[model samples]
Target: MDESSRRRFLALAGGGGLVAALGCRASGARSELVKPLPDALFIRHGAHNAETRLESLSPGQLVTPNDRFYVRNHGPTPRLSAAGWRLEIHGDAVARPVSLTYDELVTLPSRTITRYLECAGNGRAFFAELLGFAADGDPWRDGAYGVATWTGVPLARLLGLAGLRDGAAWVMPVGLDGDGYARPLPLAKAMMEDTILAYRMNGGPLPMDHGFPARVVVPGWIGAASVKWVGALEVSTREPMVPANTEDYVLLGADYPRPPPVLTTQVIRSAVCMPWPGLLPAGRRTIYGLAWSPFGAIARVEVSLDGGHNFTRVARLIGDDLPVAGTWWQLELEAPPGELSITPRAVDEHGHTQPPLSQQRLNDKGYLFAAPVPHPIRFV
Candidate 1:
C-alpha cells in the first residue's frame, strides 16, 4: 500500500481503538461504552460506529482488508478473552447438548470460503433522496457491505456432534454482547455446506470487534443472521422468534395487512465507488463499483452516464465471479466537460435486476433498498 492508503488503514484500525478508550473514560465505569468514530476509512453513525465510504473500495479489490472492513455493532464491542470462551449447543431438539471451548472448536475440521455480509438496510438513504419516502433506521448508503475469506468449521458438523433429534428445525445463534442478541436460521440453511462457525478471518484470528472467539457465518445472508460473539446455539423444533427476527428484519408497509415477510437472502444490488459529487478530468475514464446478489453472482452490469435513461453494458468484470455472492465490475467511457449523472444497474444469475427507486417497495424499517444507485460527477 502507498503512504496515503497505509495512513488510512492505520487511522481506521488504530483510531477506532483510541476513540473506544476515550469513550470508556467518558462513560466512567459503565458496562457499555459508546464506540468512538475513526478519522479515516469510514463515516461515523454513532459513538461506537463507522461505515465504509463507498469510494474507498477500489476496482478489483477482492477481500476487504480487515482494517477497512466496516463495523456494525448493535451494542458496545465486548472485551472477551479467547481462553475462557465456550460455545454451548443445546435446546429442545438436540439429543446431546455440547459445550465446545474455543480451542476444542478450532481443532475440528476446518473450511474456508469467500462471502459478502451486507446489512439489510444498505442503500436506505436512497429512499428519501430518490423516491421521497423516508423511513426509520440507519440512513446507510452503499458502504455497509464487505467480502471476506472466513475460515472455520461447518455449522452442520457441530450440529451433528450435538445430534439433532427428530423434528429439529430452527437453529438459533446467540451473541455474547449486551443483553445478548440472537437470530434464528432454518435448519436447512444452518446445515448448508457453506454455513460455518468462523474463528478466523482473512487467515488471522477474528478481530475483537468482528467477533473474537467465534461467530456464525451464514454466507449470502443478511449480516444479522451471522450473529457475532456467538456463545450458544439453540436447536429447536419450532421457528425461533426473537426481537431480531419479529420486531426487526421483517418488512412492514401499507401493502401488508399482517406482519411482513422476514428478510433472508439479500436482494440484487450495485453501487458506483466514485467520490460523491466527484470531479473527474475530461476525456476517457473508467468507472468502477461492485454488484452483489445473495441468490447468485452478478451476471451482467450496465452503466449509464445520463442517469438511468440509457445504459451501456460494462466493458469488463474485474474480480472472481463467484456464482453465489458478490463481484466487482468496471466500465470505460468518454465524457465531455460538464455535469454528469452516473448510474449502474446489475442483474444476478437468478434473473433479479436492480429496480428503479420509484418502483421499490417501501418497508417500515427502511430495509433492502436495492435500486440502481445514482452518483453525480462533474467532468472538469
Candidate 2:
C-alpha cells in the first residue's frame, strides 16, 4: 500500500470503542470459545458473539487480523487438532462416500483468495434503531464482517474426488460445534471454483476462534453458509431446510415476498471508520471508510452531509478494488459547528446502490439492511 492510502485508511482507526450494543440486548447461547475478548478490539454480545471493532482497522491493513475477526457461534468452539480431524463426504447425491483426514485433505490442490466474510444479519441493528423495524438476533452494527486471505482446497475438487453424482441440488456442510450446525448451499454455488474448505486464514493456521483444523469459505455468500469446524459435507438431491436456512437466515416480514426469500449473496454495503456516534471539533478533514458488494467491486461512493437528501462522490479511492472484496476511500470536507450527520452510499459494478431511507423495510430476521442511514455526529 502507498503512503497516501495508508493515511486514508488509518483515519478510521482513531475512534474509541462503541459504548453499547446498538439496539436490543440479548444473552444468547453460550460460546465455548477459549479466545480472549479484549475490550479495545471487540464489542461483546453476550457470551457467544464478539463483534469486530471497526475502529481497530489500522492503516494499509487490508487482511483482518485473525485475532480481531468477529466470532458468531451457535454453540461452543470445539477443540480439534489436525491430527485427529477427519472430513466425511457422503449422502445420496454422492456416488461414493469418502472420508479424508486433515493430512490427506491438505495434499490436494489448493487456492488462495482474498474476500470479505459477512453475516446475513451484519446490519440488523439499523432496522430497529434507524427504521423502526424491529429485528431479532444479536444487534450488530456493521462489525460482523471482515476480509481475509483464505487458503484451502476448492470444494469442487473435493466433490469430484467423492464422485459427485448427477441430480445433486444442495451441499450442506455440517460443523462439529453444537448439534452439528449446518446450512445448505445450492449445488451450483458449491461447485463454483472460488468455494473452498479453508484451513488457513491470512497465511496462518486457522485460529480456534475462527475454524480450527478446517472451515468452509464460500465467497460471495452469507457467512453462515461457510460453516466452521466442519466435520461432514452432506450432498442432497433437494434443499436441506435446516434452521440455519429456513428458520433463521430466511427473510421474514409482512412486506417481503411470500415464502420469504432465502438469503444467498450479500448486497452492497459501506460504513465509516469513525465512531458510530462521533464528536468532532469544527475544521476541515478527510473522511475515510470502506465499501463493497457480493456482486462486484464498488463503482463509486457518495457521501451526504444533510442526511440522504444530497450526496457527493468521494474525492478518491484507495487500494485495489477487487470484485467481492472491499476498498477504502477518502473524502475531504469542511465541517461547521453543531449537529451533523454523514451518510455514505456505495454504488456497485452492477449499477446497484443503497435503497433510500424511504424504501427501507424490516426483514423478519433483519437479514439484510443495506439502505443508507445517517451516521450521527456533533461538530463542536
Model 2 scores a TM of: 0.89
**Candidate 1 — what's its lDDT?**
0.80
Report lDDT (CA) for all predictions. Answer: 0.80, 0.80
Model 2 CA deviation exceeding 4 Å by range: 1-31
Residue-level lDDT of model 2, residues 332-355, one tens digit each, is 878888888889999988999998
RMSD of 2: 11.0
- Give the per-residue lDDT digits (tens) of candidate 1, residues 271-360: 888767789999999888888888888888888777887776564778787755578888887889999888999888878898876689
- Candidate 1, residue 142: the lDDT equals 87
